[model samples]
Target chain A: MAFEINGKTYETDEEGYLANLSDWNTDVAGRMATEDDCDLSENHWEVIKFLRDYYEEYQIAPAVRVLTKAIGKRLGKDKGNSKYLYELFPYGPAKQACKYAGLPKPTGCV
Target chain B: MKQIDWSSLVINESGKAVKKFMYVNRHAPHGTIYPLEGLEVVLIGAAFDQDVSMAFIGDGVFQLNKGQDTADSGMKNVALTYGALGDYEVTKLYVEQESLDERGLELNDLMNLTWEDEEENWAEKPSIQVVSRAQLSDLLEQQDVILNF
Candidate 1:
């Protein structure tokens, strides 16, 4: 699948994950979110930025359980819980947030 | 059907059986997929909350080499992923000293893998232990299951 913005085409997998992680930018993330009928909010950006930084360090998209714990440690208890994350990305925190973050579907994620 | 306490079966609560799972990585990190596949199994197994450890021997020792630049090679550099093993509770990593010596590698040649001890005020501790061939053999014998890649 592909999406176009400003005359450039962004390729994605069948599941809508970016084909090339390097192709991702804030604009790409914003466009992807818009496709899902979701708006770009500060809360959503926080999780997306966290996932990008995490993938940079670990070279893998963390599972939801791991993401939650790490977010709790870094962000705070209020923003780290599943409820808050789920509210931000309703499809599933790790799976949906990681797609917008331009990472491959998280390892071990169904 | 009755509700099963699955966590009780795998978790090491007192009186519950917890077996030692040793993943022996014996291949290079990039040439073949064995090392990556083995690491994935180790991570999944860690969720069971059993006694888990890993032994890096032969070409496997190269998996922990520091500053791996795979940008031009087209292969993903997964060396950084090893750093997260600590968070998965798979901390015990044994590196065969004989293997390192054969390759002219030193302890500093490998990545500094560590885990935080939540019980001890979150103190950081090293996870890799360099051991001799004999020592690794003895450790291998103690495992309930030894998975070799």
Candidate 2:
């Protein structure tokens, strides 16, 4: 599937994750969140940015447990746990945030 | 409703038994999927918390060569994933010296992989070790299970 923003087209998978990670931009992410009936906030952006940086370094989207631990290390305890992360992305942190971050679904996610 | 200790069903009275599991990789990383698939299996197996290790001989030695850029080739650069193995606690990566010598490669040609020693104040320690073929044979003999790819 594909979506257009101001005459620029972006390809996405059947599940709505961006087909080409490089095609992602703020507009693309915002458009995706809107489709899910979720508004993008500073808190959500923090997790999205973290996921992007992680995929850039690791070449794989991390599982939820790994993401939680890494977030605790880089962000803070208050923002690290599953409860806090779930509050930001209701569909599940790794699955939803990674999609918004233009990453493939995590390797271990069913 | 009662809560059962599920781990008790798997572990005997001797406590959890950790086996020496070795994955021997002898294939190139890009040409086929053996090495990549093997690495994924190794990562999954690590969850068992066994005494896991990997040995690289033959073409497998090339899997560790540095400066792997796959952007132009349109292939995923899984060489970078080797760096993450340390986090899985599969830290012992034994490379055969004879294999490297045959390919005219030196120890420096490989990536510098390391694991942190939580017991030693989280000190970084090298994970890759170059061993003679004979030494590798000895290691193979000691493993409770050996998987080859």
Candidate 3:
């Protein structure tokens, strides 16, 4: 699949995940969110940034439970629960958020 | 346009293409990665907007037993992950009744899972259902794809 932003076409896999990880940017995330009918908020960006950083450090998207615990440690308890993360990314924190963060889809039972 | 097998397309009431995917979990949790890995596949499958369901049979029913704490074991307590299935649009969790009976378990022994119904102003709905072994077998026949773990 492909989507256009500012007349530039970005390729995505069949599931809309970025075909090339390097092609990702805030604008790309914004476009993807728009297509999903979701408006990116500050809270969403926090999770996206956290996911990107987590992937950079560990080379993988943390599972939802792990993500919740880690975010709780870094951001605080209020934003760390699975419910809060789900509210931010209704699809999923590990899958949807990671996709927007420009990382490969997490493997194993995430 | 290229030829398309229009009849092969199955769309749900909401107008999204959907396939009936059933994830079978038959292994005990914490011992093997099947249950956890199976749930992962269920979540990812749900993201594709498919009609997804899960069945807990055999020793898998033990995965849902209540009051499970792994703090001492130093393992990531994944039992709570089952509660999040509804949030991922995977609300059809069928627990085999015979499996529970044989293991001396009850519905109340498992976590109470609920999902938000966006169409109903986000009203909460129950996600887990205890089905008889025969009923579960019928359900298995209806699935377009079955992922066994």
Candidate 4:
């Protein structure tokens, strides 16, 4: 599949941008930083990938409160906790991360 | 391009290339978070520029609450879903003001953040239509396609 962002065309696997989006989870956030073309820090990747997985399962992006604890439980150490999650994505973690992942916005947000 | 008026909680978009949509989130959170249904519509709606309106009524009014807590149950909340609708330039977010007041919620405290400033107070913002039982029945009759969640 091909998608154009900012007028640049890029080819993706059958699952749309899932391959590229999923590759940036916590461990690979930094390595793919240059490739993904986003200056995303690890913290940024943490939230983004979490949101992607959440969206994949439920088919709905989660609000902040859900992002906070879900990350905390899954990654351990609260993964920066609520305050940290807010710092990473002030416009709201799920929304910001989804944009970075090149995925559609989460569903039923608000 | 299937034209669907999705006021109910049924997820009409799955495994397809949706071209037209009518999202109606008529169920409130809590017992009927039905966010999943609305969420599916919102994401798909954001992918195109057709007839897509996420209208809120009845208990579904709570779907727009500012603060939500779904993580405790290991579930993600529905805030971002509302935010992403703008990316696709959703037609408009319709809210029935009467629904909020009836639930003891004020308009200011209820709304998805994605609709901030411009979109939040969009001139085309959802109408807070307060109606009598007679009005609701009449309104239902007027809709070409209606979904009740």
Candidate 5:
């Protein structure tokens, strides 16, 4: 699948994960959020930025549990809970947020 | 490790090409569903008659440590599932020696797993093998696919 932003088409897998990591941009993320039927809120951007930073360092998208703990440690207890995360990304924090972050799908049981 | 000529052994007994699959366990059993789910996948793969193996490295070795009692933890004792792998015909289990030594554990500290060899009139056979890091690396290189957990 492909999406257009500023006249440049960005490719993605069938599940909507970015086909090319280098193709990620703010516009692409906005488009993805729109496709997920979600409006990009400040809270959503916060999680997305955190996920991109984490993927940049670890080269892997963390599972939901690990992501929650890390977010709790870095952000705050209020923003760290799965309830709040799910409020932002109704599908799944790790799967959906990581897609917007243009990272690979997390492996393993998650 | 014996190096068999791949060209000479193209098809398996079922006339289908065999694929060597290595499942890498890098996390402990509990606190995460990796090892549990990894074992489930291995069982499913084995049912398809694939050449399946598991490598316990780093914290993954903790999954096989003996004297585990999950009663107090309120979690099911999933480690016992390792023993059933033999029945699934998924017997190749490699434990990294360096990982065990670093953690101050020996082979005796792990669960004694055995498999029934039907060809040998139901004789019991050990399923686990402790190998050096270099040996494990060689084994990893030979796998057609490696599923890291």
Candidate 6:
């Protein structure tokens, strides 16, 4: 789906993903952040970017264990710890981030 | 603290044997060990001195499908476990319809087992109540001693 926000045309998927774009407007970003239940911050983007890469590669959303390992490798061991991971996405990282990324809930999420 | 009892491994709680159990299976077999572990428990539920009801939902439904043919998966191929269920007195098998569709599976995929009592089969499991997502929560709310696989 394409939208003209503040006269800037942008594209997203049916689930509201920014198509081939990195930057986003404050309001839309905020909305996405709220939907994902994460406070808007640089840290959240790290997880979000990781999720995008995961979905791109596996074509399936990862559960938290997979997410944490991937994050630990890319970011650092501190970020990948289960307690820290849950602190970032209280409802659960893989679940909340997938929602914010405008993707369907991952398989085996339950 | 109430001790958790695996269905297959459990014969008596404290001292008395229990009957009329509800067994819930919650995983797919391949990626996780939960499925095989769940089946072992289900077999116990069947061996219990009382009646047992089996509920297959989410990826757990994979356990009941017939002709699974997975001997090469380097596991016990626990798919055969469902066939032996009836032999052990586990006659009632209830599957959530929504979960079937979500996984693009159907009743036809299951073993040619008898439907549970017609009352539950009318709606939901009609045997035990095939729960939709919300219905699952409600059903869980009603259980007294539930064993999840």
Candidate whose DockQ is highest: 1
DockQ, model 3, C-alpha based: 0.07
Order the numbered candidates by lDDT, best leading.
1, 2, 5, 3, 6, 4
lDDT value, residue A76 of candidate 6 = 83
What local lDDT score does residue A18 receive in model 3, on the 0 to 100 scale? 90
Q: How good is model 5 by TM-score?
A: 0.55
For TM-score, candidate 3 versus 6, the one ahead is 3
Candidates 4 and 5 compared: the better one by TM-score is: 5
True contacts kept of 3: 0.04
Pairs of residues at least 3 apart in sequence or in different chains that clash in candidate 3: none
lDDT of 1 by residue, B1-149 (tens): 99986653444665668888899999988889998899888776766768999999999999999998888997787888998887777789999999999999989999999997867956889999999999999999888899998
Fraction of the native A-B contacts that model 4 recovers? 0.16
Evaluation by lDDT, superior candidate among 1 and 6: 1
Clashing pairs in 5: none
Per-residue accuracy of model 5 over B20-66 as CA lDDT, tens digit each: 89999999889899987887677556655678899999999999999
TM-score of chain B of each: 0.90, 0.90, 0.89, 0.60, 0.92, 0.66
- Output DockQ, candidate 5: 0.01
Candidate 3 residue spans exceeding 4 A from truth = A1-110, B1-9, B12-16
What range of 10 consecutive residues in model 2 chain A has the weakest lDDT sum? A65-74
- Show model 1 residue runs off by greater than 4 Å: B1-10, B13-17
Kindly list the per-residue Cα lDDT of model 2 for residues A1-108, writing each as its tens digit: 999999999999899999998998999999999999999999999999998987788687777877886787679879989999998999999899999999999866
The fraction of reference A/B contacts recovered in model 2 reads 0.28
Task: Tell me how candidate 1 scores on lDDT.
Answer: 0.88
TM-score of 3: 0.59
Candidate 4 lDDT score at position B7 = 60
Candidate 5 regions exceeding 4 Å error are: A1-110, B1-8
Which one wins by lDDT: 4 or 5?
5
Using TM-score as the measure, which candidate wins?
1
Give the docking tier of candidate 5. Answer: incorrect
